[model samples]
Target: MPGFVALTGPPAVGKTTLAAKLAAVHGAQVFRLREFAHDVRHRIDVDPALFATEDPLGWLPDRTVRVLLDSALGGRGRNGVTVLENLPGTIIQLRTISEIGRRLGLPVVVIELTASDAIVIGRSLVRRVCPACEPDLDADPHRPARAAAADSSTCATCGNPLRRRRCDGTARYELKLRRFRSRIPGIRREAATLDLPYQAVNATASPDDCLRRVVAALRSTQILPCLPADLPSALNGATP
Candidate 1:
């Protein structure tokens, strides 16, 4: 049997950050919403909203789902945990995903990370870009500064401009909050109904400290067999 872990939270609340860290520590493979959307986008000519409106079930086909389930269960010989970020699209579909995991005999854990609204706003403001096409500027050595300076450059990864045009920081923050509000209700509701244990993490603190707490939380619930004895210290301050 395999194991599945899902991370969900409000905007800029560190779901993805924790997912990355969790994947690193546990040697898990990540399957994020954006990456999943990207895969679907490459196959179909449709906007995000269009795709969402058309196939609310998920971006992938039924066949793809089966393949993914098999792979996640180690049927294909690729073995590791599956760390899903922004999964379980809506409240109604939560059980379906959980059921799949259960049928596959995978132990599933869900963690919700949160922070102050202000922290989310700040994170959205300076989010960086595709490193390849956005060349560095001598004046501003940092990535975000250089990206902002050469904002018009096309992304080497996607060939899209390094832009926040339609969904800049303010817009993204607003949309994120709106989406968060819409999603949290269902997340909480479904969590209450599920057999899987749910954990809430205050990621407003430093990532390292947050990770320590997260590991401890998982350990407390007996989700993991054991946590490493020598946990690393959190870098920077309590908040970033």
Candidate 2:
């Protein structure tokens, strides 16, 4: 059975980018948790009211999403890891995730990326992710990333049209940030109680540097066994 590595962080903390990079290196399965849940609910025609909240699928009963969660837990190969992005916030949601991991015979490790609120807010204001590639527009060497993202037609790396999610709006970003900050302490407590490996990485650097730091930290903690062999060159390629 494959284990799961779940990534959670404030808006614009680079979870999507890091997950994509790791997936490429390890042949890991990646899941955007809420998005997958939303699609599942939509297909089944569940209560429309659930879609009204910022995160509609996070609190759904495990029974409702058992098959979807199982598919996510099942990796491509024996050693492949499952990389989860945008993990739900809240102790109840955390417990639900743990239960799913337990039932699947997969260990779940939660990786929380931490950055200054100011940095996160600035990046949030600037970025609009590429739906296909999950590339970070904020990483472009351009000023006023929002304006750059708006002017751009497609992802520079993948040529996919850029899309703005609800959290791209300033008001929604602020709301999400506040909610995430408030829940961090409780999340840490609950994760500890669950005996889950919950780790935090400071991610306030250039994308390459931040990725390097994350890989280094996880290696030191022995949490991620399926790391890339050429870590220095692949992850630290742009570290300065």
Candidate 3:
């Protein structure tokens, strides 16, 4: 059975970037839950007013779960792994994904990236997302070259013009942080019960540093294959 990894973290903590990096290194497919949610919202023809009255997840249609599960499990026979990005925020979602993994006979691992609330909020305030390349860049007061490019509203990766997402602002980010904090204990408990391989990587470091730590953790946990011979020597050192 091929391996599957589900990554969870607070908003602006770099979960998407880590998932993309892992997928590139392991030649895996990615299933991003945020994108799945958007697809669900569009497919169901949801009323815009409903979002004002209730939490989006509260009224999530059943088809959303089906589509996400199918995408996560559909290519089971393939050689490459599947990397689920930002899924299973709640214990219920975790249990559902766990049951699906067990039924499909796929080995599942969960990795959570963590950072201080201040760092998350600061990054959220400065981040510019690239829709085409799916990497987030710090727009100001960091990454001088990238910041300079971002000043012109161009993405460093794909040269596409960058735009601040609606949910990236202060009010929404605070809400996301609160939600993340509330879910941590339940996620930890459920992951323990399911006996899933779980690891937490500190995400307060530089992106390269965080990637090295995550790669080391994955290798140590046997979720990812061992590093290639030609890979960087820095990765071979203990995860910082």
Candidate 4:
């Protein structure tokens, strides 16, 4: 069995981007919890009221766990690491993940990305998602090239128009951020109790810099074999 890496972070903190990069480096499959939530919502015709709650996972059916587990363990080939994004949001979900990890005989490493609330809010305002590539792009005023691309309403990767998710407004984003903040302590405690290798990476820097920090943290924990040779060149000298 291969190792398991799970990423958790507040909204707009670049969890998806980091997960994508890690998956690329390890030749792993990325499993996103939001995608699974969407499938469950569509299948069960979830109540709109559920969206208003701080805990959206509470509305999901029991079978949702099975789906998540299958995605994490089923299709991934032998010796293939799996990178999980925005998963195990609740204590119940975390416990379930612990069980699945044990059953699969894969050690789980959880990395949480942390950023100031102000930075998170600013990122939420200008962040755009590329549907085809499934990665979020920073389009803040400071990033001129990315901002220009976003202004032109084009995805740099797929040449499609960028998109804003429904939860992209100030009020909704703040509420979601609060919910994420409330869960952090509990998640950390659970991870410690489970004896999982957990670390918090600062996400206030550029994405490349943050990725370097994450890679370094993983290397320190011995979760990653080593930094990929091409990574330094790709990241403009980001060392492991």
Rank candidates by lDDT, best first: 4, 3, 2, 1
TM-score of each: 0.66, 0.72, 0.75, 0.75
Model 4 lDDT per residue over 41-116, tens place: 5656555443343344233543565555666465542466677777667776777777787877767788899999
RMSD of 4: 5.9
- Which residues of candidate 4, in runs, are more than 4 Å off? 37-63, 70-72, 75-77, 130-152, 157-163, 226-240
By lDDT, the better pick of 1 and 4 is 4
lDDT of 1 by residue, 74-100 (tens): 441125456667655455445655776
**Alpha carbon lDDT of residue 35, candidate 1?**
46
Query: What is the C-alpha local distance difference test score of each model?
Result: 0.57, 0.66, 0.67, 0.68
Higher lDDT: candidate 2 or 3? 3
Please give, for residues 63-90, the per-residue lDDT of candidate 2 as tens digits: 4444455655555324656676767466
User: By TM-score, who's the top model here?
Assistant: 3
Number of backbone collisions per candidate, in order?
Answer: 1, 0, 0, 0
Candidate 3 collision pairs = none
RMSD of each: 8.2, 6.2, 5.9, 5.9
Off by over 4 Å in 2: 42-71, 74-79, 129-154, 157-166, 221-223, 231-240
List the candidate numbers ranked by TM-score, top first: 3, 4, 2, 1
